[model samples]
Each structure stands twice: as C-alpha cells, then as structure tokens.
Target chain A: MAHIHLGEGSFPLWALVLWTLLGVGLISAVVYRVRKGGIKTHQIALAGIAAAASFAIFQLNIPVWGGIHMNLTGLVGILAGPLLGALIALVVNIFSAALGHGAVGLLGANTLVNASEAIVAYYAFKTLIGMDWDVFPASASAATLGLSAGAFLMGAIIVVSGVNGSALPRGDLTIAVAGLVGLNLFAAFLAAGYWGFTVTGGAMPWAKRSAKALQRGVQEGGGALVELGRGIVVAGPIRKGGLMVEFGALVLVLGVLGIGLYVYVDRYGGFEDGERPAR
Target chain B: MTVTTLSNHVPDPRLVTAFAEQRDGPLHRVNPWTKIGIVGALVLAVTVFDRLALLAGLYGAVLVVYGLAGLPYRRLAGWYTLPLLFIVSVAGPLTFLEPGTPIGGTLPTPLGELSVTWAGIVLFAELSCRSLTVVTFALTASMTTKYTDVAYMLGRLLPRPIDQIALLTYRFTFVMLETLEDLVKAALSRGANFSEFWSNKRLYARILGMTMLSAIEQSERLVKSMEARGYNGDITLYGDVSRPPIHELFVVIGSYVAVVGYAAVAVYGVRQ
Candidate 1:
C-alpha cells in the first residue's frame, strides 16, 4: 500500500489536498472576520484556545493502564471558533511536523482532522447559546454536544479518508477510537471549565493558583530534574506559556506512549498489516 | 538547482536577475496570472511522478529561471542543500530494511534489523530529486512574484471570505511582529530575559503569563476600536482591480504547454 506518512498517521493525496484547501479557506475567512470586527477579540482568544487545545490533546495523557492512550486537538476546536480553531490546529500541526510527528506533506490533513472538532464545537455552541440559558448551563450543554459532534466529525473524516477502515487495521482502529474519545472528553471538560471560569471570574482560579504556587516552589535554584518539573508546572498554566510547554510535553509524552503502545499492540493487540506498526 | 558556492560576502545581483527571468521576450508582457499558470503547470508536470525526471526538469528549469531572475547566489546555503540531508535521513535506514543485494561488505547501523542496499541509494537519489524540484519551482514562483501580487492573485482564486483573510494576514504580519517585539521588550524591562529564564521555570511562566495578559488587553482594545467603526464581515479592498491582461492568455497557454509536454515525455519514458 502507498501510505504517505505524516505527524502520526498515513493519509492519501486526496486527504492532503482537501485538508490544505479547507485550512486555507477557513484561515482566510477568520482573517476576514478579524479585519471586519466580526468578534476579533474572540478570534484571538479562540486562537489561544485552539493552541491550548492542541497542547492538551498532544501532550497530557495518563496511562489508561491498558495499551490505549489519548490525543485531543478536536476538543479544543469545540471551544474556539471553527476557523480560529482550525488555524490553531494548523499552527500546532506545523510545529509538530517540525519535530517529525508526521511527514511535512501531511500537515494539511492533520490540521483538517484536528480542526474538524473546533468547527463542530463552534456550531454546537452557537446552537446551545441561542437557547438563552444561563452561561454555565449553556456552556456545559454546548460542551457535550461540541465534544461528541467533534468526535463524530473526526470519525467521519477518518472513515471518508479511508484511514479507519483501510489505512489502519481493525485492531489499531479500536485503540485510535478509544484514544480519540478520551481526548475529546478531556479537552471538552477542560475547555468548558476554562470558559466557564473565564466568563465568571475573568480567570481560571485553579490554573491561576497553580501558577502562583509553582512560581513560589521554584523560587530557589533546584536540580535539573526539579527544574524541569518546576518548568512544567509553572509553564503549564500561564496562558500562552502553558500552551507551548503543554504542547512540547504532549509531543514527548505521545512519542514515548506511542512507542509503548506499538510494543503492547504488537504483542497483544495483534496488528493486521503484518508490517511493523507505526508508532 | 546549481548550488552556487558563495566565496564572496555579497550576493551577485546579476545572477539573481537572470534567474528571475520569466517566459523570455514576448512573455515578459504577459499578465501575472498567465505567468502564474505557466509556472504552476510546469511545477505540476514535474511533481506528479518519477522523482528523477522531476529533479532533472526542476534542475534545468530552475537553473534557467534563476539565471533569468538574476539570482546566482543562495541566501541560505544550508537550506538549499537540505534535499541531500532528507535523502540520507530517510534512505540510510530504508536500505537496510529492504533486504536487497548486499553490493559490498557490511556497514554498521544503530538498529540490528537492517542492512544497506544499492536500491536504497537509488531511491534516496530519486527522493532528493523530487525535493530539489519542489524547492526550485517554489523559489522561482517567489522570486518572480511580488508579495502584493501573490496576495491579489490568491484573493481572486479563493472565495471572498478567504481572499480577504489572505490580504488581512499579509497586511497584519508586520504589525503582529512589531507587537510581539514591543511585548518582548516590555517583558525584558521587567527582568524577563526568556533565554536566561530557562533555568527558572517560574520566570519563564511569568514572562509568558504577563505577555499574554498584555496581548489580550491590547487585542480587546483594538477589537473595540474596530467594532466602533462599524466593521462587519467584509473588508474594503484598496482599489477595484480585477481584469486579466491580454498578454496573460499567452503566458497561461505557454505554461500549460510546457507542463503538459514535460509530464507527457516523462510518463512515456517511464512506461517504456
């Protein structure tokens, strides 16, 4: 089979072209929106949210205690506007590509997959918000719809691109699906919580407090390990700082976790391709 | 494609001008769209299949383009040589995995499951050629087209929403960079050199945290100002210009012809 390897998966040329065009179209629209003041501040905030979501999706995963792991760019998009979210996913995908997560050619498709979540989220939120419900209730309801819709969109895109059915074997599909679900839920919850907190208090209390504590903890010079840990903690919640740190952390975690999954899947998961499974 | 070894400090302006030359005498008068079409067609023709032929065409075409563009010097010498690096990075390991004829003695690798092959080398060369061709065409397009013209062309090609975004992004790129710089400077004044803060995670966090806070505030102000002016989902273009030039037709035709001819010849050669 001719597989074009990218950030983490293989895709066909059609997917690449389709996704690139979509990204171009979406990003262009967002730019127009920014210029025209169709919620410009929201767009930048959405961009930040998307970046954060990309980081959360890629970096922070707890071992499911099984062979499966998680990733979550879609959930982030749900909170951010589709266009803005897609743009953020593109930025993250590009950054990831630089680090060899996928092939450079696959940047477009990867961005498209991640952005689908944000787009779905935007519509979902719009629909829920029009209900005129209270902010918290609306946010929660919207988040659920956004997350599920985002996952469904991802699944649909994957299936259409032949990624789920043919690109990956039946066994790997389960792992990927499971990972996607976990990532979506986690991202949606975090995004909702952040959105809720931001609207109510102008800041996330937990993240803010965590940032303060982390700063205090790292006031004195420490060992390399301590410093690294401290960097992660302090960097994890300072808005933009957290986003970059979180992204880097996610890439490292995913890489290590991906390798682990490959080994476990090879031994127990039983890859159908017969060739060495992609990490 | 010709890697001009830069011994001198300054780039040779004449070579760059020569390299940037478009479709010769008559084509010079052609429309930008036609020029774009020709370049696009040529690039597409070479890229579809067979990296070797693509590379060869790219090398030849780029050399001619470069000569015409008057660019004989490479700005970033290392970047231009990246094709070779990519080939080695991919092909070096692939050779061992393929299990082909061991032309000579064994070479050591970090991985125990692989060995080298002549096939791998050929594959590497082919891949290198593809990359080189892409770089050449990209460079040619960039050299020949102005940023504004490219933006204008892209705007015309895309939907109204997207086209407007391209123009906005292009216009705002410098503004964003300037904003980023000022923010960075402010951070620096407050004992925040991000490079030094690497040893201190808290400091790193503080810098980014503070920067984002300020960025958000500034963006909010900017957004408010724009909204106050009754900005909506549309941006006004500087002038009403959308007509294609008469000479552009020839340029577009020539481009398609060259691309189609190259692709046809290469495909035929490959099949035979």
Candidate 2:
C-alpha cells in the first residue's frame, strides 16, 4: 500500500527500467519458490485472500488519529509471509494505477516499495517476538521500518526524477519532496510506536513471553546494547543505493532540522484524498 | 470481462471500466497495441526533450486528438485535475524557490540573495507540461481501449504464472471492494463508526481483520465453484473477438515519425 505521488515521465527511463527490472526479478524469485509446490490450489486461494484483504483495507483510508488514516500494511505481513505479502502489494499497486491513484509507469517501483515494507515487517516481527520483546513494540517497529525504507526509496526517486525532464535541475522541488518524505518517515515511526503499545499494551492471550533466563539477562545489564545490535541488523538493505541515495537521506534529515518545525508537507503529500470520503 | 476500478462512490460497473464499450471512431478504431506504442514513444520523447515549447506542443496535439475522438472536456478535467495539481506540488515552488545566477531581479532572503534562475523558470514549465502530457496520454489510452484486451496482449508477452496472477488479482479486487463497502456500512450501522483516527484505531483494525477473514472464506467458495465448472486453472479472463482488419503499418510508421522526429528536434536543436 505504498502510494507515491509520482507521475509518468517523473523518472528517467534508465532508472525506471532498472528499478522495474529489479522488482520483476524479486517477484519472479518469489513466484518460482512458491511454484516448487506446484500451483497448489490452496496456496493460490490463500494468496487471493491476502491480496483481497490488503486491497480492501488500502482503499478505505480509515480515519485513525489526528484526522490521519491508515491501511494495515503491517498486519498484512504478520498474517501472510513474505511471498504473499509482496504479491498483495503488487495487486494493490495495479488497482491503484487503474484508478488514477498513481502512475502506471511507476508500477514496478511501487510494487518493490510495498514488498519491501511487507518483507521488513514480517521478518522484524518474527525476530522481535523471538527476542521476547512486547508484541506491540515489535510489530509496530517492524511496520515502521518497512514504511521508512519505502519513504527513503520514494524520496530518492523523486530527487533523481528531475534529471529526466526538468530543464535547470529543480533542486528546490527536490528538497521539498525529500523533506516531505522525511516527515512521512517520522510519522511512520511515531505511528508504529503508538500503535504497538496500544495493540499489545496490557497483555493478549496470544502474546508470548521470553524465556526466564533471557528475561533475567535483560534485567541485569548491557541488555540495551544487545537490542540495539539487533535493530541495526533488522534494518537491512534492499540493494546498494550508492552515493545519490545517501544524498536523499541527507536531504530528508537536514531539511527537517533546518525547518525547525513540524514539516508542513503532511498537508499536501500522498494521495490527496486517499481515505474514502464518507459516502 | 468485469474489471475493478477505484473511486469513492459507486457508479455503473461497466462505466468504471476505463473504455467505452459502444463508441466507435478513430481513437477506438485504433488498435490497443498501437496506443501503447504511441504512449511509450510520446512519454520517452517528452522525457528526453527537456523543452517547454515541445512539451506544450505535444500536449496540445494529444488534446486535439481526444477532441477529435469527441471525448468530453469535462471528463478530461475530472480525471486529470488532481494529478495536474500533484505535478504542481512538485514543480510549482520552483517558480520562486530556486537559487542560481540572476536572470533579472534578485531578492535578499535570510540565507542570501534569492534570484529566479532562467533555468528554474524553464524547468518548471517543462516539468509541468511533461507531467500533464504523460498523464493525459495515459487517461486517453485507457478511455479509448478495453483494458482486458490489453491484458490479453500482455498475457502473451509475459510468462505463464505471472499472467495468471495478474488476471486473478484484477478479477478479485472488485470482489474485495464490494465486501469492503458492505463491511464499512455494517460497521457504521452498528455504531462502530470511525471518528478520530487514534481512538478508533482498534475498530479500524477489527474491520481490516474481518475483511481478510471474509475474503478467505469467499476465496474457498469461489474455488469450489470454479472447480465445479471444470476450470483448469488457466489465465482465461478474456473472451474471443475478431482482431480488427485494419493494416497497422501506417500507424507504426506515423507514430515512429512523430515520436522520433520530436525527439530528434530536442537532440539536434534544443538548447536547454
């Protein structure tokens, strides 16, 4: 459910081809892995439900907090594993493009972005739960990490897209777009943090606990360092984005700081009317 | 074939499909593949040209073709206004925000001298026009061609399971959307209505969960029904229609000439 506001001609053809090729390769690998069991009827059915569910939830931008809306990208990963999650993400992007929500040219790019989030969330949640972290924190952080990666990639694309069509290299627009992405990334972090606690706060029957020895180690000392190490590893990387991508991160972080206020981009970014207006 | 479309409100399901089933003319008469080629060439031409005048010229030419096809201007406006605004959101600020060598006038800002670069002004127009042209071209293609037919053509281009997955996804999205609309109504009726985003977060999650559960149940039923009908798990979403008998050579040559010539102008003559 990663909705980028990018349109046709936003990207240079080479970038479009490169990202698109990478996206197709990933989906192909997933498809090949699943097909090893044959096109088992049940697997397809399960994939269908996953795609349907994500599509439905994505369409209805549920008003959740501060007039903001949500589509349950994180929950999709938790319920469905990496392969089906990516499949659902691709389907969601297809529908979105047909409905004029995003550019068809960006189909491959958008799919990769959503798949990244789903994959990140799935592995992150599993690892966090294994470590006996509270379900809320684990799931939310997992979700946040997925979405943050998406934001970064999207920002980088927007920045590089200027080279494709603009005459003088519109660096100011690039900065604004990058700044907007940064703000969205920050929002993802906050939302995941808050959503995690709210969902798993007291205790759920399903929530598991860490082994007593592991719990005791956490209570002793140096537990934070171990957790921090895990966080760094789980952050992961899709591919080496090189220097231009690093510059995108610089724009996002530095722009947010230089503004010295809540970036106003939230007001004008994404699908302007993503949440289905009450009918 | 039925198709899924995104909109906030319901309309005739067929209308939701991007093509007009009844209209017959130059646009509709043109083959879907040619339309795809034209769009690809035109978008590429715009991308490499980097010329505002050339972009504007291409955009006007596209509109004239749509006009010749009798597409209502109101419909064009309805579909493309937000996308146009989104393009502005990216390119609009460059009208004033860019800093470079002064073209004419300069203003002192907190940071330093703020001057409107000739480059920035041209960049803004080029990008805005490029974005509009590409978006309009996309809408025009969808409006004039049956997407299922295009998918069938694509089915021939891609591998087997990928095509199967694509058609299946398209078919099921509508199924899911109906289920979703019904669920939202039921939720509201039961006073589980969403008010604030945060407080009702759990309610939202519950709705999403329920939707997925229902989709799974629906999928099981659908599979059973499909199996009963002797469905062999092939990607057969489209039905047979005779291919149009028109020769495609002219379309190929004309499109190449237009797109290539346009691009050549940018390569050989464009200053920016």
Candidate 3:
C-alpha cells in the first residue's frame, strides 16, 4: 500500500548508497540466520508460495481509493514468519521493478519499506495472539499497525532523501510527508475499523445508527436547501433542513478561514522561491 | 469483469515467458549477463549525470536498442504510463515553485505568484529519461531472457534457501495469477459490485483473503508432491547460464570504465 514510486536519481547519490547498504545489511542478516537455522522443507514451500501470492497480488488494482493496490505484506508476515517474509518483500519488489511498476534504482529503499511491514506485522500479531486476542482482531490490528509503520517509514525515506529538483526546503518537505503519513494512518484505521465492525456483526449498533441518522439528516437538509432556493420554505420548526443550513454555513466559514490562514502564511512566512527562509 | 480491467497495465507473466521462449530475436540469443551488465551501466550513467542533453541521448540510445531487439514499441509506450505519472507527480510542483527564468509571465494569485520555470521543465525531462531508460531496458531483458536462464541466474546470484525460494516463486507466480483470475471471475459471476470500493470493501477483503487461503493450501500440496519426489530442502535449478562472449565482456568492461571516468570528472573537475 505504501510504496515509493520515485524514479532513478530521485535521491542523491549519497542517499542511494546509504539505503542500498542498509537494505543489503538487512538481507545479509536474514540470509545468515536462515542458513544457520536450516529451514524446514514445508517452511521453504510456504515462503515460495507466499512470495508468488504477494507478487501476484501486488499487480492487482482493487477498486478502492480510486483504484489502489494492497500489499498484503502483513498477511505474508503472519503466514510466512519474519525471516522468509523479509525475503519475500525483496523478491516481490524485484519482480515488480522488472515489470516497471517500481523503479529499479529505488529497490533498496522499497525493500526496506515492505520488509519492515512484514517484520512488524509478524511481531505485532504474535504479541496480540499471546495476549489472548482473537484471530480476526489480532490480525486486523497488526496489519493496520504494520501498514502505518510502512507508511511512516516511506515518508521518512522521502523526506530524508529529498526530491532532487523539488523547491521545498527540508522542513517543508517533512511537514508535507508528515501530512501524507497521517492521512495514510487515518485510512488504515478506517479500513480496520470497518473490518472489525462487519466481522463482529454490528458490534456498535448505536454508532451505526448515529451514522445512518447523520446521513439521513444530510440528505433531508439538501432537499430542504433546494426547496428554500425555490422560495418554497416550509412553515415548520427547524429540522434536518435547518441542520443542512448550519452545515453549509460551517463549511463556508471554514473555507474562508482556510484562505485567511494561507494568506497569513504567504505574507508572514519567511520563504522565497526555491530558497530556504531565514530561520 | 473484462480482461483489460482485470489485468490493467500489468504485463502478463505468461506472455512474457511465451515471448522469451518463442521469439528468436538477436536479443534472445545474447547472454543475459551481458544485458544485465549493460543495464547496470545505464543505471549508473543516469544516476551520475543530471544534464538534460546527456540523459536524452541515453534515452534515445536505449529506445534504439529496444527497437533493435525487435520488441514491440507500442507495448513499451503503454508501459511508460506509470513512470511518466510518477515523474509528473514529483516534478509538476517544481515548475511553479522553482525560481528561474519563467517561460511565461507569472500569474498573480491571492497568495503568491506562480510561474513555470525553464529549470523545472528540464528537471522533469531529465527524470523522465532516467526513469524510462532503466524501465525499457529491464522489460527488454525480462522479455528476452528465458525463464530457465533467469532461474539459473537467481540460483547463482542469491544465497541457498533464498535462491530456492525465488526459483519456486517464479514458477508458481503464474499459477497463483491464474487462480486469482478465476477467483475474480467467480466473484463477478455472483453479482459482486467492485466499482464502489467503500460500499464493497468487505467483498474485496474476502476475495483477497480467499486468495491467501488458496495459496496456503496449494503450498501444502506442493510440499507433499515434493516430498514424494524425494525432495530435500534445496531445489536445484536445471541448466547452467553461459558466459558472455569475450567481445561482449569487453563492451561491458568499457561501459563500466566510461561510467567511472565520467563520474570522476563530474565529481573532481579535470585539471589542465
């Protein structure tokens, strides 16, 4: 879900070397451990199949978030364990890059992003299961956390590497990346919350009812606004229609406030075109 | 779902394998190692040089090589969509934010003035060239190199169990893809609505979860079959990769030397 789609030379040479070295170091450690421990034949089979599954799914575009793809690295971690899971991340990224889905030069950075997802998911799931959580909740929570960690790491990499031609300063880039990560975390949690809700068969009926009421109220308010626009105001107490008017006013005020804030920043914020501001 | 929508822009692994096996092109005959070495050199060249002219030249040469390999230019163009999108998303803002000789007069907005800069456009072009060069060559290599050769290379290049896993993964990826396609078909047949993601998130999750479960079951069967065939932990790849011919080796070495020389000159300016 969180993949760096940057091109070759997107990062400076030093960043490229640093990320590649770190990626290689991690893979080396994993390989050394695998060789020493001597993996069972079944485990080997699982890893291969898991890699195949991950690679296949990586290419798929689910009709979510305007056709986004899911990594399922968390599931790979849970099933294949961390060691093989990390290896699977590398294999998947390599195959993906070869097919032009990701940049070959950024393979090292991408592998780290994905491998961390798998490793974190594996440990999180284990800990949750150890704490006597159910499979559905444990897996869901772990996967969410894993994806959030990957998103955060991806943002960190981008900010640290810094886009070669971007005009934004490091501080500004960090803020932008932080906002992106926060949005990703929100989406992850939303999906997990929905999953939990459905799996538990409407565990929070009151919350569901509240959502339905809000939706209904919004719809009714929209209808009332159209009526008012047509000069056919109903002679009744304020209801859903009034709620709609209030919501519209709130949105208008917020929009104005946002514009005001932007103007303030433009005038007061010490930034110049492609140049860092005086601290 | 239509096949186009099901697969999107992803290159069919089966088609890639078929091309490698069936195409009797000059590229197919060339050693995979030589192609890989040249790709490495191209990557380095793109990384070290930021000049638009040099990057453009490299891109043109790569396209020529791709064409000479008898690969389909139409498909190559189609594959450019993702890389181009990436470049645009990253470089688009720079056109306004970068300080330079604006191509057009700046437009005054409430917040600030926005202008497209020559430097920004050059940066965008440079990135596109760098990205597409590697992407085109990679596709060419994968399409030309046989699966067995790729497996052998993986075996030789990667460590013990990882190599074995990669080999098996490569072989089974097609199988898993077919399985997924079937699953999608079944779901669509049952009146599944995939267009509205928020409304059908559960359905999407179920389909993916089913694919995972299918993979686990398939792996169990695979393990049993391997055990029956007297399989040990190691899965050896059949056939050995031939070395690049001597002349090709020289070209590869020369490319490396040229890249190194260029990098040295770029980093430490040449003295008179």
Candidate 4:
C-alpha cells in the first residue's frame, strides 16, 4: 500500500538544481533574442504591457473541464512566443509560489511544462494559419496536440525524478509515474478545451475572426459613448435598446446554465475531499 | 498559521542580529564548496531514510547546529510552523495507517470515519519532522550564503560553458523584475485601468498585445548591451577568497558528527 500511496516520494536535489539552471537559461536566451530584434521603443513598451496583462491572465483561475483548475501560463507562452512569454511565466509562477500555489522547488519543472505548451502553440498557429485546411479543425487539432505535449512532459519529469538505481523498486516507481500522468493529463485536457472554446472563440481562422468581430463591437460601443459626450444626434435609442437586449439575453442564458450546474453538483457528486465549497 | 517571518513587514530583530553576526561568523571563513559538499551529504542522509525517530534525531541535531550558529529559536519557529500546520492539516489526514482497519471512531460522517490508529499518528509525526529538519537546514544555508556565492560555487564545480549561462541568468533576474514594475506603472497611467481592461475584451487584447511588444523590446535591448560588452555565450566571474583552515575543518568534521549522531539516535529509538 505504501508503494502505491507514497510511490517514490523523494526528489533528487541535484537533478532539481540542474533542471532549474536549464530552465532559467532557456528564458535568458529568449530575453537576448527580444533585445536583438531592435523593435521600436513604444512597441517594446507595448510588449511589456502585454506581458504584464498576460501575467494577470495566468492568475485568473477559471474552472474548466475534468474537475481540475490551474493558471493558464502555458497559453500565455504560446501567444508571447518561447522567449518573452516564458520569462513572464517564470516571473508570474514565482509570485504564485510566494502565494503558496506550489513549492519554490518545483519552479523549474513548472516553467518548462508551461513554456513548452506556449512554444508549441505559437508554432502550431503559424503552421496552420494560412494552410489550405479548415481553420476550426486545424486550430482545435493543434490545441489538443499542444495540450498533450505539456501533459507528457510534466509526466516524464515526475518519472525521471523517481529513478534511483537499486534504492527504489521498479513497481513503486511505475505507480508514481502513472499517478503523475493521470493528474497532469486530466488537468491539461480540460484547460486546453476551455481555452480553445472561450479564448479561441470557435478555432483557427474563424476563432481569430470572431475575436476580431467582438473587438470591433467593443470599439463601436466606445465610439457611441464618445458620440454621446459630444451631444451630437447619433444612432437613436432604438439601436441602443437593441444592443442591450441582445446582451441581456446572452447574460440570461449563461446565468441559467451556471445555476443549473450549481444545483447538479449540490445534489450529486458530494464535494471531493480537500475541496473547499464554492463561496 | 500566521508564522511567516520571512515575508513579515516587521522583520525579527534576532534574525537581523544573527545575520549581522554572520558577517564575521565562522561559516563565512569556510570555503563555499566545502559547505555545499557537507550540505549535500546531509541531504542524502535525511531523504533516503524514512524512519520517524531517525528523522526526529536529525531535526534535533539541526536545532543544535542552528543554536551554535546563533540562529534565534523564534525566527526558526516562525519559518517552520506554516509548513508544519500544512503537513498536519493535509498530509496528516491522508496518512491513515491501515492497522487491521481499526474500529471506526465516533467522528462525524463528513470527516469520513477517520479510523486513525496509533501507527498513523506516529507516521505523520515522523514525516512532518523529517520535512521540517531538511527545510530548516535549507533555510540556514540560504540565511548565511549570498546568492552570488552559491552561483560562484556552481561556476567552480560545473564546466565553464554551463557556469557562464548560470551566471548571466542570476545577474539579470533583478533587472528584468525592475523593468516589469516600470511597465506595469506605465500601463496604469496610460488608461488601461484594471476594471475597464478586464471587462472589455478589446481593451484586454490591446493591453496584452502592447505588453508583449514591450517585453520583447526590453529583452532585445538587454541582450544588445551584453553583446556590446563582449558577452559571447560565456559569463566570466570574479575569484573566491581564501577560508581559514580551522573553519573548513569544523564544517567538515561537524557535518560528519551530526549525521552519525542522527543515525545513532534513530537506531536506538527504533530498537526500543
């Protein structure tokens, strides 16, 4: 039972240190690339803003699939690219650690896991963006595959840490390995699905288009506010009423679904051990 | 539960005093690598052994070393209690030793028939002590050694190529942090207020895109400065100062004695 339960509980300090060095090196090299790109100062300023906002995005821990929730640091990596994005994620995770989300010791492994996802997402998007395939299919497929890559790497790190010739039994090590695979992959898939749906807004070229349209709608709404401030005769109350009506309907639908979920979970699936009730 | 001295706004005076005393302390006179080597051996001795009483003895020996090093008990206790409460509340509940499925006590149902036998309590206590022992020693090392010294030691132990990268990463960490702070302040001043940015997706996108561009640009500038100064994939660092022979010998001999003492206590306790 201890073999299954504890399953290779020790970590090699040297291995952890070495991995941290490698992870930090990868981030530093990325920083070097960003410096060499010779972008305009304002653009550089913009990038900093983007990175900080992305850091906030990583902290926004929304519930997703599979009964597991984690910060979307990996997605930020994809959007920011390997170098700058990874650096930001490293900073964010460090702050998160100080808040007790995870240990300072696991920083290297966590950074690598999230950074790989980001790198993979960037390349995947670039590869499939203008390809002659259906945009949704390509985006969804890329996202799904990228998520699996993150999960596999996280699992592999755990397995590697458990290896100690002659000291730990093979069976015990395997149990630990399996446990990591189950936990990480389960969380990864749910996160990938949520990101693909809400953030991507339907996937591929279409996802990009939807996001752009939403952005335009928001821009138009801002323009309306400005127009009202100028006291000029603009789009009448009817158009404003119509927009509000549409928004109200959408909110109403989501509110109903959320309440439904609350009721269902309350009736069945008694909250798991160690889980705090929704406040 | 509130024992977080390291991050506390009002730092402990004893910690400050102990740290100040360490400026002219014995450990400072010892070679960094020697301290590291002894730390490594002690880490292995603690981790590879799972015996509870053994871990407690290890903890005892560590307390004595800290006492000798002039580390205040209040400071140590402050740092140690949080992880201790965490282990008891979480790991303790999970470590239910199945001693013949001991009679289900009259504990409430939501607590889930917690059939904790004597063995379970003992195991949890041991594991918690073991973790605290290693953690305290780590804190001691961190409290004493400067980060640069650790990086320098790594530079000595590792090949020149690998060590160079380590040095660069360590040096630039603070610089990047400052850049991040400045960027965040700039954003707040430039109308990307938190509530508006979050509620409006377009504003959020603009904010995100802008931040990314700036971070990339900042990174590029940093790299260029490094390159201009003849930084070509390798980092060069300064030399290490000589340590007194007596201090080095104490670290070496004291570490051995501590490990042996821990083992003896463990063996005796287990036999009983």
Highest lDDT model number:
3
Badly placed stretches (over 4 Å) of model 1 are A1-79, A87-110, A113-279, B1-32, B51-54, B70-72, B78-92, B107-113, B183-215, B240-248, B261-272
Model 3 misplacement above 4 A: A165-168, A179-183, A190-279, B1-5, B103-114, B267-272
The alpha-carbon deviation from the true structure for residue A74 of candidate 2, after best TM-score superposition, in angstroms, is: 4.0
Q: How many backbone clashes can be found in candidate 4?
A: 24
Candidate closer to the true structure by DockQ (higher is better), 2 or 4: 2
- What is the overall TM-score of model 3 with all chains considered together? 0.81
lDDT of 1 by residue, A1-279 (tens): 001221122233335455555545545444443333333433443344335323322321122221111233333443344544555566555433332233345455555555565555444544555565543454345545555655555544444443311223444444444444455556556444443334433243334543332222122101011113235422112233333444355446544654554455346533355542222
Alpha carbon lDDT of each predicted model:
0.43, 0.59, 0.71, 0.45
State what share of the real interface contacts each candidate retains: 0.01, 0.37, 0.59, 0.03
The residue-by-residue lDDT of candidate 3 on B135-180, one tens digit each, is 8888889999998998889888888777878888898998888888
Which residue pairs in model 2 clash with each other?
Answer: A63-B197, A64-B197, A64-B198, A65-B197, A65-B198
Interface RMSD of each: 11.6, 8.2, 7.3, 11.6
Per prediction, the TM-score for chain B is 0.64, 0.74, 0.91, 0.64
TM-score computed on alpha carbons, candidate 2: 0.72
Best by TM-score: 3
- In model 4, the Cα lDDT at residue A248 comes to 45
- Candidate 1 lDDT (Cα, whole model)? 0.43
By the TM-score metric, which is better: model 2 or model 4?
2
Quote the positional error of residue B185 for candidate 4 in Å. Answer: 5.9
Q: Which digits, one per residue and each the tens of the lDDT, describe model 3 over residues A17-75?
A: 66776677667656655654456677788778888988877666765544566667876
In the range B1-272, model 2's lDDT, one tens digit per residue, is 54333333212224535345656657887777777777667766765565567778888988888777766676567556556555665656555555445588788989767777765667666666776676666666666776567567646655655555556665676677777767677777888746665677666655655676666567668778767777665746554434444566566667778766765554434344
